[model samples]
Target: MTSATRPQLEPRISSFRQNGMRTDALVLSEPGGKFKYKKITLRDNLLEPDECLVRIKATGICHTDLNFASKDRGQPENFPCVLGHEGAGTVIKVGSWVEDIAVGDEVIVTFTSCAQCRNCETGFPGYCDRWFKYNLGFSRFDGTQTIEDPKSKKPLKGHFFGQSSFAREIIVCETALVVIPAPTPAYELLAPLACGVMTGAGAMLNIVKPQPHQSVCVLGVGSVGLSAIMALKTLARPPRRIIALDILSSRLELAKKYGATHGINTTYQKDLMPTLMEITKGAGVDATIDCVGLPKVVEQIVHGTARRGRIVAVGVGLLTNAVSINTFEAVQAGLVYQGSLQGDSDPKRFLPWLLKMNQQGKFPYDELITTYHVEEVAEAIKDIKEGRTVKAVLLWDTH
Candidate 1:
C-alpha cells in the first residue's frame, strides 16, 4: 500500500516524565549485528491512556525476529532496534483507560491492531488495515519512538509487535496485552503462545480445519509446525494422515511425538510430490499448512495437493519475496492458497483457550521450548538458526 493511502496513526506517546525508566534490552545495532544485551531508557512517561507497563518474564525467539534483524541497516525497523515479540510477563502498571487488566496480572503480549477496522471487527484482526503501521513500524503509529540509549542519547527503535519484549520492561498498548488469571502458568511455557505456537495451532484448527478422512501435511516441523501437528491431534476426528516435513531428522522425530503420522526429511529426499502422493495412497494431500515460506517449496507443493485442497501459508518471510501461482492450475485443480498472520487468531481470546488446552494436556506446547537466560541471546540465536532448538525462551533473571 502507498503511504498516501495508508492509515496514519495519531501520535500516542505519553508526555515526558521528570525521570525516564531504565531497563535491560537486547539492542540490535546494525544489519547482521550481534544482539547486545544492554540498558535502554523509556523516553517519555510510561503508558498512554490505553497502555500498560509489563515486566517481561520470558520471551520466545522467532524466525520473524531473525528476519527483521537481518534486514538492511537503513530501514526504520533496522539498526539499533529491539525485536522480540513472543513475550509473557506480568503487568506492572496500567493506564487510566485500562480496565479488566490490572497491575500484577499475568499477560501474553502479541501483535496490536486498529480495533475498529473492518478486518478486526470481522474477526480477522491480524489483517487490520493498520496492522503493519502498528506492529511493524518500530514506533508508535504517529512516527514517535519509545526507546532510546540512556548513555549516549543514541536513537533506538522499538515497539515491535507492540511490546518489543526483547526488553526487560515495556509500555504496551492495551490492544497487545492479553490478560491471564492468578496462579499463572510458567512464563517460559506461555511465551511462545504469543505468536509462534499460536500461529500453528490456530492455522491448523481455525483456518485449515482438516477433517477425519482428509490428509494434512505440515512443512518445517519446528515449533510452529509441531504446534499444528498437536492441534490436528486435538480434533475428535482428526485427519487420517498427518505428514511432517523438515530438513532435520531430530525435528521430524519431535513432530511425531506431537502427532505427526509420517515424517519426511526433505533434505535427503529431493522429489517431494511423488512421495507425498504415495503416502496419501495416490490421493493428494487435503490440507497443507506451510510453516516454511520459501518460494520453491511453495511452488512444488502447489501441485501436490488434492483437488480442493487448502494450502495455508503462515511463515514469516520478507515482504519483497513473492510466490508465483499458475492461474489455470489453481482454478482447474480447485486449490485454495491463502496467507495468514498469527494464524488469524485473536490473541485476547485464542491464547487463553490455548493455555486452557495446555492445562488439560491436550496441547503440550511447552515441550517445544528450550530455555536460555536473557544474557545468552547469542547462543539462542545460533541454536535456533542451526535447528538445535525448536523454540528458545529467554528469561529475565540471568543478567
Candidate 2:
C-alpha cells in the first residue's frame, strides 16, 4: 500500500445532480493492516432525510483509527468501512425531522448517542445502551449507510462515531451534533476533542475534580497525558504540585510547558514511584491518572498514588491487560479507582464549552497540534507512535 500505488477513489461529479442530495465520503475497503491511502474512496451521493449532510473541511486522525484499521486488535471492522470519528464541517443539508439545524451551519461532529436512552437523558451518552454500534459499530443507528461505493454501488458504513468524515462530506444524526463557533480551529483540533483529548481532560475536570492545592500525578505524557496537563492549568484552582511521568523526555518537556510543576522522565529515573514520592515530600499525590493503560505502568501508578488518593485509568490498554491492587491496602487507604470514557462528558455541552475555553486562551490546546495532509496520515501515525508528535490532524483541501 505505498502512496505511489495507492488507489485514487474519486467521487463522480455527475452523480451529484442525479439525487436531490449531494455529499461525498471516504470509504475504507479493508482493515487487515495499516490504513493506506488506497483504502479510502471519495464519492458524491445523496444523504438520507434522517441525516444531516455535512461538507467536512478538516478531520483528525486518531490512534483509534489506526487501531481500527489494524489487525492487532480483535473485532476487526468489516471492509469498505468509513474510518473517521472527529470532523469539523458545514451543514450543507438537513433532514426533514431536524428543525433546529439549518443548511450552511457549521458543526464539529462529536459523540454518537441514542438520544432517547436513559443514560443520554442523564447526560451520559457515552454509556448509551446502543453505544456499541452507534459509536464504533461502524454503522448508523439503523445499521445502514447514507454513502456508497460508486463503482460497486454498494452500501457502506458511514456513521463511525456518528460521523465517518474522512472525505469531503458525511451524513450525521442531528442529535449527535455539536455546534461550534464559526471559523474556529476545530478544523484542526476537533478530532482530538472527540476522543483522545476528551478522555484526558475529562478525567481531570469530570472524574478526579482535583481541589486547590491538592497534589496530582499523571502517568504517560502522550496525547492524553498532555491534555490532562492542559486541563490542570485551566482549573479554577489548580493542584499545588502537578507531576508528569513518561518515558519520553521530549513529551515531559512539553508537559512542563503545559503546566506540569514537575516532570519525572522515567528513562533517567531509577524508580518512578520513589521519584514521585520524593517530589511530593513523601505525602504522595492526591490523585494519579494512568494514561498509558499498560498493566505494569498502571501498577506503578497504583503504588505511587497517595494512601487515600484516587486513581483514574484513562488509557486503552489491550483487553488482555490487567492490574492487581491489594484489597486490604485499598480498604485501609480508601483508594478510589475509576474508568472514564470521553471524559464522562455530554459532548453536546462539553465540546462547545471546550471551544469557548480555547477561544479565551484558557485552553490553548493548539500547542498540541502538528498538522499534515491526508496523504501524510501514515507518517503522522508513525510520528505519534514513536512519540515525535502529540497529535496529527488531516486537512482535506479537495474543493
Global lDDT of each candidate: 0.84, 0.74
Quote the positional error of residue 79 for candidate 2 in Å.
2.2
Clashing residue pairs in all predictions, respectively, total: 0, 1
RMSD values for the candidates in order, in angstroms, are 3.9, 7.7
What is the TM-score of each predicted model, taking all chains together? 0.94, 0.87
lDDT of 1 by residue, 55-166 (tens): 9999999888888887442364456899889998989888776777888889899998767778887778899898888898887777677788887776688888877999
lDDT of 2 by residue, 1-399 (tens): 221343432333333234333344444566654444533233324554446877777787776677676665635446767778878778887865666678877787777776666888888988888788788777665555555555566666567787887767777877677777666564777766877788788888988899886888888888878888788767778989998888988988988988999988777775567777788888777898888777776677677778789988877656677889889878988888888878788887887787778878887777888888877777887898888888887777743
Q: lDDT at 306 for candidate 2?
A: 84
Error of 1 at 183 (Å): 2.1
